[model samples]
Target chain A: MSLSVRKIVISGILGAISILLGVTRLGFIPVPTPAGHATIMHIPVILGGVLEGPVVGLITGAIFGLFSFLQPGAPFFADPLVSVLPRLFIGIVAYLIYVSTKNINNILALVLAGAFGSATNTALVLGMVTLRGYLPFEVSLSIGILHGVPELIVAAILTVILVKGIQRIRTSEDRPPVS
Target chain B: MELTRNITLGVYLPGETAIHRLDPRTKIIAATMLITLLLFIKSYEAYGFFLIFTAGIIVFAGIPLSYALCGLKPMLPVLLLMWIFQFFLYSTPDANILFSWWIFTATDAGLHMGNIITLRVLFLFTVTTILTLTTSIVNLTDGLESLLKPLRKIGLPSQELVMTMIIALRFVLILAEELDKIIKAQMARGVAFDRGSFIQKTRKLFPVFLPLFINAFKRAEELIVAMEARSYSGGKGRTKMKTLHMGRVDLGAGLIMLLFTILMIYIIISAAPQI
Candidate 1:
């Protein structure tokens, strides 16, 4: 339907933002961690899921995953399972968390959704990396803690602020023009 | 950071070589075959052959060696780290120990593994860069759409998927430009992005991303309204203005690929693996 086209357009833009973040290295913020940088790339997928539905989130996540696979930093992400599959779930999980918690409290729902979405990416990617024997389980876990905690914090704060701003815009648009 | 200047992905360099003229599907399939071979290649001899073959392709495609490799500069640090990791961590029981340092040992096997993996990554990147450099975005979309049409039988929305991919590629540059502007505007406001401690620098980035993302979403909304105004719908019953056709050039490329694949298989079976 017409709604689907709109979804596609939004998803495409978000997907572009994800890829742009990777290409330009703008997604990487210099955090004093083992990895030296924390990525905001996954934020787009989270935003897509919150603003639209799971389908848009899934599409945007796939694009993000594909870019990661193409330009893998670690050998583990060269595998599609590590790179693509985990990303596909980011949007779906975020959407589910957001929907389940929306009635309880809006800001809390957005924060939890963002944190969980980021946590899902960290857990799944590192879990698969260890399972594949790319790095030792202990090493993977430590790296995840060092990198994931900061990423989750950033994702949660940004997602809450972004969702609130977007909602305000939508509600205002819904209102009639002031004379 | 002049990030846009360094990006080579999705930046099509127009050329008129045979590799450029071949159908995009053929190039895609060939790139896939080469990447698969890269995953299994274990011997230095095979890698030497791969280097020659890739270099030949770059020459045939008329891409300058320097231009083809400019993308690798930013990647050097990651590649070096990977090499170092493989040097200390990857080892076989029979490996000759080169050195030992506090719970870490470098071995001959680890050295070879590191070298081979780094080479694999380098060639893999070069191959993909060549593909994008020669192939225009429109041709890539059309070729991908046509190639993926068979999946439509399983109710897969391939057209919409390709459309999304194309748009994402196009926006890589656009978004980077927008990001550059945001960084400059922030700089004009006396934000010192480069002078802070690591954590402080990271925290400072929050202000930049907030506006960038908000504007991105606003642009997305405006895009949606614009598309809706144009009566845009999903890829239902949509027809292509220019349909794809396989020519004699594609046949030649296919034959060459088949021969190369067989030769690679032979080398893989015959050569001794480095590990």
Candidate 2:
């Protein structure tokens, strides 16, 4: 199916936010982990999924993955397997979680969607890095726990806050004007 | 405060050098080929050749060597850390141990692993940087759209996808400025973003992000309406104001890339795998 202009613009803008975060280092949250910081860069991708749809999310994730792969933050990320392949799922997973859980509670759905999306990035990226023999399984596991927990928590909170805030703007704008 | 200054990924350096004059499609294809070749390069010989080739491209493009490498400055620490991690952690059976320290071992295999991966990453970044440097964003989008045109028959919205990428590139700088503003505004209100515990610092980001996301969505809504009002449809029948043409320079560049690829492949196949 063809992409609507809305999907195209939203995905592109969110992808811009993702890339901007990477460039400006605004996405890196200070953590005491050995790797220095945990990232909320994938938040834009999750937002894209929750706000627009899976296609938008997927495209935004692709953009993020491409940027990270091209100008890698870490050396192993030079490998497309570690950098690009696993990132494709962040938004799709977020979208799926949000849609499936939203009927239960909107706020809870946002938190779960954010948590799972961040989890998808950490787990899949580390899994690929380990599988590719860039880092040992034990090291990757520890790094995941150290970095992933913080990233997950922050992403969950940010998702709830940012989604609620954006939804407010979106719903109001989307409403038809009274005659 | 200067968030946009260090961003070089989408930045173009206009020039009249042969490398800059080559068609964007040719450059994109060549860069992709180089990246693919890099993946199978497990030996130092291949990387050596790869290094020479990339250096030659830099000179040909007339890009100052320092400028070409400046973007990599912030990444050096991370690169070194990754190398250290690989050196101390990556191993194979029957590998000769170079050193051992409490629960950490450095082996010959690990050394090779670290060196190769680090070199690969360096070359990868250089190649992509050069491509973006030599090509303008508009040319890149046009070339990519033209190249992916054939895929449209198979149901890929290639043009729209490229359009999205263009938007992504265009908005990066815009959003970065907005982010800078938000951070400053928060700091002005005594956010003290620089001094805080991990949780406390993270707590500060919420105020910053809420405004950023809301502002971005507002811009998106405005952009959507503007495009729709202009009778914007998908790329079904859209025509370009300027068409692309591949001239003699592209042929020359193509031949050079072909020769380099063949030589690199030979070196790759003949050299023993490093690890």
- Tens-place lDDT per residue, model 1, B1-275, is 68788778899999888998998999998999998898788888888888888889898988988888887787677678767877887777899999999988899988887887688778777888888999999999888888897877788888878888888888888778888999999889999988978668777887887777777877878887887898765567778898778899999989988998898899898874434
The segments of candidate 1 whose C-alpha lies over 4 angstroms from its true place after superposition are A1-3, B92-96, B271-275
Clashing pairs in 1: none
DockQ each: 0.53, 0.80
**Interface root mean square deviation per prediction:** 2.4, 1.2
- Indicate the docking level reached by candidate 1: medium
- lDDT at B269 for candidate 2? 76
Which candidate number has the best lDDT? 2
Candidate 2: stretches off by over 4 Å: A174-179, B272-274
Q: Which residue pairs overlap in candidate 2's backbone?
A: none
Whole-model Cα lDDT of every candidate shown, in order:
0.84, 0.89
> How does the DockQ of candidate 1 come out?
0.53
